[model samples]
Target chain A: MGAVKQTLSLAVEQHARDRLARESEAQLHGMWVVIPAYNEGKMVGEVVANLVTLGLQVVVVDDGSADNTQAVAKSAGAIVLRHVTNRGQGAALQTGIDFVLGQKASVVVTFDADGQHSAEDIPALVATVRDEGADVALGSRFLGKMHGAGLGRTIFLRLSTFVSNRLSGLPLTDSHCGIRAISASALRDLRITQDGMAHASQLLYSIARHRLSWKEVPVTIRYTEYSRAKGQNVTQSLRILFDYFFHRSRGGQP
Target chain B: MIIRAVFLVLLALLTFYVFIQRRRLPFNLIVMSLIVVAAVAFILRPEMSDPIANYLGVGTGADLITYLIQVGLIFATVHYYTKFSTLQSEMTKVVRELALLQHKVERLTETEEQTGVGRDRGRAAS
Candidate 1:
């Protein structure tokens, strides 16, 4: 009986040691950067390169781009998933999230492929999610002291913020920022059904539904001429609003 | 006259069948309401029915209107069915992609586990 007890105690100690080692390994696990690219072949490679330099695993979902986005992202050491048809930004993001979650990513960061999102801001967002106990960390351009946003874009973002806050009852300062970090739990639980630009609203609704804690940190979005041209226009903004309300009226959430 | 009577009975049967089929309630309601209105009109003014039937392209007024409405409803139903099928196809594509990605992740996790086990064995041997 004494021998058996000794053996059992040793086995328990070994199990505890193994658990500690696994926890340490998890702490060192890298972040997965998911970039949804739709014909931004020019900037995708650069974005992937920057994220790679930051020691993050990158996955680029090429949403049926007519350009060489898939080739460029693959060449840049990014796991590339190509959709056969042109799905919208929301669908592309869903694919990216699925890929990143598959990669066993401890944290997932969604960065725009249009070079608007600064790679330098990625670490800050990831740190916020890790250290602040936040389920998701959003990069907000309006929260911090930032400059160089066009008047039109600022107004549009404000309108979106107002609508999202009213609908979701979440105190979010910037609801439309593309740069965000989601914990593994949040990523696994998020069910993004929006197939178009209305995904921003969907994300907010999902966060509210899941009751995930989120924070918005100050980040800079460099709006280059190319990115500005490809960005959402006034008409697109109206269409997104229309789609959101239409889906809601049809008993669809987000 | 027998042919007309048979056609009227068939129309009444179709209208009754629409109501009996629970899945198409909204459609059945619209169709049955139209049929009831037409029936009431014919019963109220039997003389006007013959003139209206002559003006229409059919042998009888009730036959022409019923045929027209049925054709229109069938076309509309076909259009909605196509839309539903398209949505189903899109949803299937999304689900298939997600499943493929999930499988890839499972394989990756297995590989990682095997590698970790191998590393542990080597350390223990040393």
Candidate 2:
């Protein structure tokens, strides 16, 4: 009876361990990280290497960068995809998403290649989709630690968030956060066509249109001098605004 | 009379060229056909434009024709602009797809060569 009791406890312990292993495996099994990069050759290698070390499959879509972004990303252990000419960030992202979806990835995460996003935040975002019932998990800088953002950028981000919130009606803390995780199911229901910075606003519009459940998680975004130099400036914001206006005027869907 | 004759000859030549290339440029043919029909109407019955112009708040028949030409020019400008934008969007899509495919092919070739080399090494070891 003593031996039998020991055996039974061992069996129970094995079952619990198996369940935990299966749960974690399921959490990461179909997760893919897509990075849309334009002229980010200088930083893409390190960015991709960082994500690869996290054990996530990474795909880098080089948006026709004149630099050696493709070679750098491939050398860093990423599946490198390229655009022949510079389609904007939105188009690059759509290409990456389409490619990953074809590979049967269940969860797709969009990470910026400017090295602004922390790879550490990815697990929680994936968990939000895998364990929780959320279809879209957006990483909000406002909710978490943010470094390197200046006063002017802060006001611009806040103003854009307010305007985008009113326009898209998502009403979250941050509207234009680049790091976002989307489920394959929600992605099927959504289509991105703006091919520009206005694509962020379009994403929120898609969320509202499809009525997909979404949640925000705190994420750290580093605004280094390199990233800031590569980032969109004031004139680009006006161009993005004009793009959204033109897109809305044309009935808004591709 | 000389101007009308020259105009009709030019219209005939345009119609012939458009019809010949109808399969490749169907939109151009349809547009040119409409313009030819309108020009023929004006040439045959110059009086018709006067009433049309008066209704459009112009004074004389020649004035009305001139106004109609301006309207046609504006319409053509808008039409071509729309066409140009659509073509530009299509071009972007094609370029993006081409880039992706080219990279994919290059990657596949490299993988094949690497595997081939590895296979040779394995045979030598055996």
Which candidate wins on TM-score?
Answer: 2
For residues A1-254, could you state the per-residue lDDT of candidate 1 as single tens digits? 99999999999999999998787556547588888888999999998998776566888888888999989998998888777777788888887787677667789889999888888887788888999889999999887644556888889888879987887888888888989999998977786767788888888888898889998988998887888888887689788888677667666675
For residues A1-254, could you state the per-residue lDDT of candidate 2 as single tens digits? 99999999999999999998787667678899999998898999999999887668999999889999999999999998888788888888888988888889999999999999999999888879877979999999999988999999999889989988898888899999999899999998777877877888899888988899999999999999999988877799888888777667767652
- In order, what lDDT does every prediction score? 0.80, 0.87
Candidate 1 chain B has its poorest 10 consecutive residues by lDDT at B94-103
Candidate 1 error regions (>4 Å): A1-30, A145-148, B1-89, B95-126
| TM-score for each of the candidates | 0.68, 0.76
By DockQ, the best candidate is 2
Ten residues in a row with the worst lDDT in model 1 chain A? Answer: A21-30
Task: In model 1, state the lDDT of residue A68.
Answer: 98
Per-model C-alpha RMSD: 11.9, 6.6
Residue-level lDDT of model 1, residues B2-110, one tens digit each, is: 6556656777787677778788768768867786667655655555677776887578866766787799899999688657745944774675396456547766777
CA displacement after TM-score superposition, residue A162 of candidate 1 (Å): 1.5
